[model samples]
Target: MSQDYDKILKENIEALILPLADKLLGLSLGRLEEIPDDIQTTLERRPDFLKRVISSNSHESYILHLEFQVKDKAAMLNRMLLYYAMLKEKYGESIKQYVVFMGRRKPRMSTQLKEGMIDYRFSLVDIHQLDYRKLLDDATQPEQAVLAILSNFKKSEVDTILPEILRKLQALTNNERKLRRYVRQLEILSNLRDLQKETIKHTEAMPITYNIEDDIRYQQGIKYRKRQRRKYRGNY
Candidate 1:
């Protein structure tokens, strides 16, 4: 992933909801107890999504682990395997791991490792392959509704889908300030699909306003990203 998209990913990690986790990542979990994800024992990085969730089907407790992957980097499986081991040691519970790939290209990275005496694998899903409408259909809150931006939708449908998402956000969140944050999130995630312009146009049309000049993500972090063209692109 480029630096710009990576920044967007970091910004949205906390915002990405469990409804996305359950559907996109295929984990039927309930009553999640979020645990600290920053357990950097040997590696310098932390897991993107880590929580103790009760299995909705079995009614058992286990660790639900998920990661948002934008790039098919080398040694990706190695990193996940490492995470599995670290999380297993810490939590001592059965684990479920998944990687939600949101990059432009098809994912080429291997998801399993079958060594001489070991067999390990993790679930990998491409966000573009899922149905965007179904995501909104399952969404019960504004946070879940905003994630529809990352799911599969056509170029012509940008005007349609984005507006629906904004409307859902408006209906769910009676708070204007909260709606603006989801607008900012959609603006950032739309770049991964190369639909930033359309996202901003419809978002600007909404009743709530998203002030890019005041948003710290727009001013400080996304400043050097030249590919993400907008009205404020040249201002900073």
Candidate 2:
């Protein structure tokens, strides 16, 4: 991934990718805790291109791989099948395979020939289909707010419908513990990335602006003041 694309990926990992992965792949906080160590390591140590993998509790499991494809390639299934084989070899047999499609548009699924045997078993999730409007109606209050904040990248266009989004977010934060965790994670990641980008820009234009002493003072004073407010608020 190019630097710009990588930045976007970093931004989306917590906001969009992780949430969607959890939703479609049946990953919850409790479920994730049950994954075996070897499988967990494989997921954690995926190559630069691959995003994640998930497995179920039953003996039968499917490996979910995330990729960003600009254009559909002919050998996509073949490549995924090969990855499945590699994973099986690393672990033992008795593992299924799936490749998640995360892109601007939906991808056309194609059949693959595996040594003259046919195999076409994978899943695709076009992020574009996660429309804010659809989620607003179908999703619970928490999910609705999550979808809205997750779509912060599309804020300008989405701002028109944000009254409901804000309502959902506020409601979710007050009620759902799990969703509150997700929202906090998303906020932390987004803020860190934004700060990183701003720091990089300032360093490139005026290097001396990268003043750690001043930053530490500001953090201690301003951030500490905000943290102290937690005592006054019941929900904080």
Q: What is the C-alpha local distance difference test score of each model?
A: 0.77, 0.45
lDDT of 1 at 56: 65
Encode model 1's per-residue lDDT on 117-156: one tens digit a residue: 9899998889887788888887777767877887887788
- Each model's Cα RMSD: 5.3, 13.4
lDDT of 2 by residue, 188-229 (tens): 322322333332232234212233443423455777778778
Please give the lDDT score at residue 115 for candidate 2.
Answer: 58
Determine which window of 10 residues in candidate 1 has minimal summed lDDT. 1-10
Point out where model 1 deviates above 4 Å.
1-17, 36-38, 56-59, 209-212, 215-236
- Once fitted onto the true fold, the runs of candidate 2 whose alpha carbons sit more than 4 angstroms away are 1-3, 10-18, 25-30, 33-63, 93-98, 109-115, 118-120, 131-159, 162-236
Best by TM-score: 1
Measured with C-alpha atoms, the lDDT of residue 192 in candidate 1 is: 79
